[model samples]
Target: MNTLLEQLKNKRLVWQANQQNAIANTDSTGYQELDVALHGGFPQQGVIDIDSAVGIGEIRLLLPALRARQQQTQRQLVFIAAPMQINGEMFAQAGLSLEHILIIQPETPEHALWSAEQCLKSGCCHSVLLWHQQLEVAQAKRLQLAAEQGDALHLLFRHKRQLSMSLPVNLAMKLSPHAQGLSVQITKRKGGWPDNPFQVDMTKAWPTLTRVRHADNVIQLPQSKVS
Candidate 1:
């Protein structure tokens, strides 16, 4: 009994310590449908990866969180796009404030990577988004540690194949745009079913969610809202 009590107390202390130094602070993914897809919302100080090919639903997936960061009461929102091009009009379309976002177009991928690392280290922005097709384990580990040090969320966008392999990620997943629908599959998670997969239709996202037969599906919309 004493051992069990001591173990529990130690666990609490560890949790408290994690909270104290935790960088895992976030509001919500801007998109309601996507937030439900992510099991709640993205972690504040944890590292999250979004893998998608060009001209897919990746932009849609990030809109929610970007919007949320722009709405944060704490700090400004920053996005560093080295490989991809982010336009002011596109940001406005996603409900992200142009003035609140500091867009850094690095001359090279290396420079952009450095910018991202520095941004994470500074712990200034409410959130940081990095566009890189390849992320080495070392780089990810560094960002992960940085996120843990301060309360910040790092969103790394890579390719679809990136999640197919083992990597340094708290949650590894792939998102693709279907026929007016969005499909998501979990590659890895800290403590979740690796085989669990889910999808949400774009049309069913905003006002209502229309349930469909996607083998075993996990619907997260309101009962009345679900069709």
Candidate 2:
């Protein structure tokens, strides 16, 4: 009986590996440097955890891909309990359609997690973004599995301090504001070596500098502010 169970487990592992290989697709992240680092772009289905200090250009870095997805599929992009209010006009200026974006403000972190998982599993949205600083490993795994099953893009934004704590994800990166633009450091990735931190000039996507203000070494701007 034990032997049979072991054989079944092995078969399941093999099936999962085959599925992963079959579904893997290379999508460009719109940033040449990041594309080379990630071997294309973000994974089509999995949890992508981004850790960054507040006011960094984390969301700005993803605008291009999000905009492309919005235009390509015409699917709604869902935001669950975002830490800051999204500026629709800013996203619009960046080429993302405000009509295609849906923002959800959950009352609690647990509610946000539950909503995110449900949104991913429902397959109603092309991508789901969740901002929660405190996420348990199990919760992260749940979100990852939900993303995989739904075949949707899932981006989790967390505080930089969470970098010390591990989370189950396909890709993990540390984002910071640099003089040139947004500095992206691949902290974790599957099936490839992480490269050195690279700069992505967000101004290319967003030429309007009305939002972000960098002065005296202090970043003062609204959420999703682009440099």
How does each model score on lDDT?
A: 0.66, 0.79
My TM-score estimates for the predictions, one after another, are 0.70, 0.79
Clashing pairs in 1: 23-45, 24-45, 25-44, 25-45, 30-64, 30-65, 31-64, 44-152
lDDT of 2 at 137: 79
Predicted candidate 2 versus true structure: per-residue lDDT over 1-227, tens digit per residue: 87977896774321232343322575678888888778778888788988887666778778888887788787779998777778888898878888888999989888999999998988778899988888887888889889877878999988754556767678889887775568888987765545688877666555563245456778677789689
Error of 2 at 31 (Å): 1.0
For model 1, the stretches where C-alpha displacement exceeds 4 angstroms are 1-27, 30-37, 162-165, 204-227
Error of 1 at 24 (Å): 8.2
Residue-wise lDDT of candidate 1 within 1-227, one digit each (tens)?
Answer: 87977896774321232332312433566556545655666666667877767656666666766676667645667778746676688678767777777888888888888887777767677678788876777778888877666567777878755334566666666776665556777665544445455664565443233234454566777657556
Superposed on all Cα atoms, model 2 deviates from the true structure by an RMSD in Å of 9.3
